[model samples]
Target: MPGGLALDTILPSEIKERLSRGEQLTIIDVREDEEVAAGTIPGAKHIPLGQLPERHTEIPQAEEVILVCRSGNRSGRALGYLESLGYKGLKNMTGGMLEWED
Candidate 1:
């Protein structure tokens, strides 16, 4: 958790529930391509953590964006970076795919 107490988080179950209810969430998978090849959230966009600085614009600024990774670490860092750039409505998916699959 890069922001520690300031980092916002949403559980995998919560995301699934929202999607089930037809909520169109903006989920960004910050994991690398190889890791993503294994699988990912149903509709999450991939933007590997390292590329975020240059690819951040691809993410929506007006919607609630959920950052996800292998665990929760990288996405947390991604959230912090975006926050520094003044991006709002950002959340890190807690436990990432590991918990998502669980």
Candidate 2:
């Protein structure tokens, strides 16, 4: 991650606060369809980790993208990939959905 956008972890509480303030942010749930069917944060977009490479262009280039998954690991990986692709303001939701609903 040297000289690159190191993966950043943001707490769910922080996400909530920023949204409450009406900040326009993008939350990308990297979980598969089955897991996402259970639930996802309000306003989050679904882009399974497996399909990310082909569909990465679907994500807006100018927006900050926050990634989420069953746990933080997958999303962290997604963050690394996206960062490598030159996406900025990218972050992983620390603890992922597990912490978000806890």
Candidate 3:
């Protein structure tokens, strides 16, 4: 793994700024349907973590993919999996939706 993979984390503030500026990014919510029904980050794609390994190709190859969950932990695990699969430019949204709302 490249050292940059070790740095694959983003703050909610940074994501907010990117969205506000109309920057294109692939924001993925890896939480379950029940969790998403409660709330989610605007414009995020729903791909529950359990489905990632099988649905990996559904994720774009040439985009900055931000993984999110209720908290940062799950997303971090997702990031590791994606990295192991050679997915580039994957970033875990730090503190996930919980921090993003704060």
Segments of candidate 3 deviating more than 4 angstroms = 1-6
Per-residue CA lDDT of candidate 2, range 74-99, in tens? 99999999989998888898888998
- In model 1, which runs have C-alpha deviations exceeding 4 angstroms? 1-7
lDDT of candidate 2? 0.88
lDDT of each: 0.92, 0.88, 0.87
Candidate 3 lDDT over residue span 30-97, tens digit each: 99999999888889999999999899898876678999998889888988888888888888988788
lDDT of 1: 0.92
Best by lDDT: 1
Instruction: State each model's C-alpha RMSD to the native.
Output: 3.0, 3.8, 3.6
Candidate 2 colliding pairs: none
lDDT of 1 by residue, 1-102 (tens): 465544489989999999999999899999999999999988899999999999999998867999999899999999999999989999998888999998
TM-score of each: 0.91, 0.87, 0.88
Candidate 3 displacement at residue 94 in angstroms: 0.7
Q: Which regions of candidate 2 fall more than 4 Å away from where they truly are?
A: 1-7
User: What would the TM-score be for candidate 1 when compared with the true structure?
Assistant: 0.91
When 1 and 3 are scored with TM-score, the better candidate is 1
